[model samples]
Target: MLSEASNFWGLFKSGSKEREFRKAVEQIIGEKPSNPLLYQLAFRHTSASKETNIGGFRESNERLEYLGDSVLGMIVAEYLFKKYPFKDEGFLTEIRSRIVNRESLNQVARKIGLEKLIQFDGQRIAHNRTSMYGDAMEALIGAIYLDKGFRFTRSFILKKLIANYFDLDAVIQTNTNYKSILLSWAQQEGKKIVFEIVQENGKHHHKEFVAQVKVNGEAISTGGGWNKKKAEQEAARRACESLEIKSTQ
Candidate 1:
């Protein structure tokens, strides 16, 4: 453990940076942070830095992101369970998935200024990977869990993150399942729809996928993502925007 003097000096040395971080946190979380290390790890991206200068095995925020993902899901589930006691399991699960999905999380993170605050190596790569901000948000949640315990983390997620950021009623009324939406519309219109993986590129550790959404044997739109499912989802979302207006279905 670091001595009090050492900790004080450490804070003194990092006073400027800490002030910046504190301001950012206040904007995001609506309060000053008691532990800043967790927030640091939350913004640290693997693409930007691999191994930390510290002696431990941690290289990036991947582990923290993993932990945060599970924790956030559980909290969302519990919140949904309590809020929608009469709703069935399927309804709760589907709504929870929408609330915690990559695109939705990324949107929330970007809206909360995390995209500007996130640390990464290159601008191009960082901008290209849309999920980076979302991943950082999850990792930050993990950090919050470790530093502030479950009660604080839960409040932050439900009250600050979900309540303030997301529109659950809008989400419930509108289906974000692009694939299902496309399929149902095509079926109603008596048209054929297909999603094909046209390309897969990137390093072994990180893969990029390009998916094309074809409607009635014509490629309507294309989108790329870190995974095929996400790519397909994007493609379908694009297809909906393009074809939806044209078809009454």
Candidate 2:
């Protein structure tokens, strides 16, 4: 299931495929899903979207991911607020961002065996499949919220995700903002650094951008992402790696 597969036959169909997928989801989430369609859509990447019979609407996880992003953010914020009663907003926000950032979520999704269930077009998005797993993780949270309720979803996130996958002390001590680090290094070294979008691919909602970093008019590194900012950060990350610039932030 890690590899890309074709689209689901229909939104309402409950065939063997759905059953298999349901079992897989149960193993990952440790709960039986009430509605299979939502969970199915949770792992469905945009490249693997299917056109519905009505209105020619393509069904993907984008909408679910949007909902899950907000839900996850709120849940994390609430948890951080309660756990660190004396901490300021800035500290909580930073912790939440570190926990929910693309690379962090991507690593968590892989650890939770989400890669086996995600369905994407490997051929179509071969080179730019950076954050699809993390996106799917958010979409899965949305599905869990809809399938269960807020209370159950909150518990699931707190117990199943944050408690299991993250160590708050380690997360607090780490800073992976490559762009900020690169900028700081450039400022200290008095070197001019620029990030340029070299290429853009895919549709409007599912666009992939390639960013190149140039220091003193010489291209240093290039990287890709689902958006421009991510792309730039990726490029900067590579530049940092190449230059052996350790993060000071």
Candidate 3:
């Protein structure tokens, strides 16, 4: 009787597993997987191994994450360079930071609903950290690269990710502050401009301060920086740019 029950359980479990596997494949490839086993392995988190019974033959996405990191960096760097030929190194670095930061990558992952399909144990899944999700997203990209080749992956990134979310012009323009220059100009023109440090946080050596610049009793702009002078300058620079103050006195 026990042997018969075991056989029945195995048959039912196999069918259920196949259905779940197919759903995961559909989610990743946007269609049924030709190689269903590969899709199954891709979705298998290290923690879920014991239940899946795949043994040591299956590999986790860690290696894929490493490859994807390099690929993403290269792709984003190339894209930025070609898009902004006139941009200097410092300017380019800042824009890249905004684009490839942890928050940015997580946003991209959430946009694609990649988080829902991630397989993990209850404890690991419960944490729901941004870094974990972002890592998985990168690993998925690497898997896609391996499966579909570079051209397809690149086109997908351009169409589905870059074109849909990122705005090149907006990123470049907001890279730096011009308000400080305007404040200086106003002062030189015998006009009054005041920069008040409203708040400060962090240690003395690594302090961050927020400053608001006001011109003739009207608040022009606010900026944050590592120091009072820099913060004030950023605020003033922004004010100048916004107001279109031309004279650089």
Q: Write the per-residue lDDT of candidate 1 for residues 144-192, one digit (tens) a residue.
A: 8888889988999998889888888987876778887788788877999
Query: What lDDT does the true structure give each of the candidates?
Result: 0.79, 0.85, 0.64
What digit string (tens of lDDT, one per residue) describes model 3 on residues 1-249?
222212332342477856865665466446555555444444445544433356545466566777777777777888888888998987677777667655567778777766555555543333243254666667766776777777766776677778887887775555333544564577677778877999897654246789997888888788877667667766776777677776332
Q: Best by lDDT, which number?
A: 2
Residue 11, candidate 2: Cα error in Å is: 15
Lowest lDDT block of 10, candidate 1: 1-10
Clashing residue pairs for model 3: 178-237, 178-238, 179-236, 179-237, 179-238, 179-239, 180-236, 180-237
What's the residue-level lDDT of 58 in candidate 3?
46
Question: How does candidate 3 fare on TM-score?
Answer: 0.54
Q: For each candidate, C-alpha RMSD in Å?
A: 6.4, 3.7, 11.5
lDDT of 2: 0.85
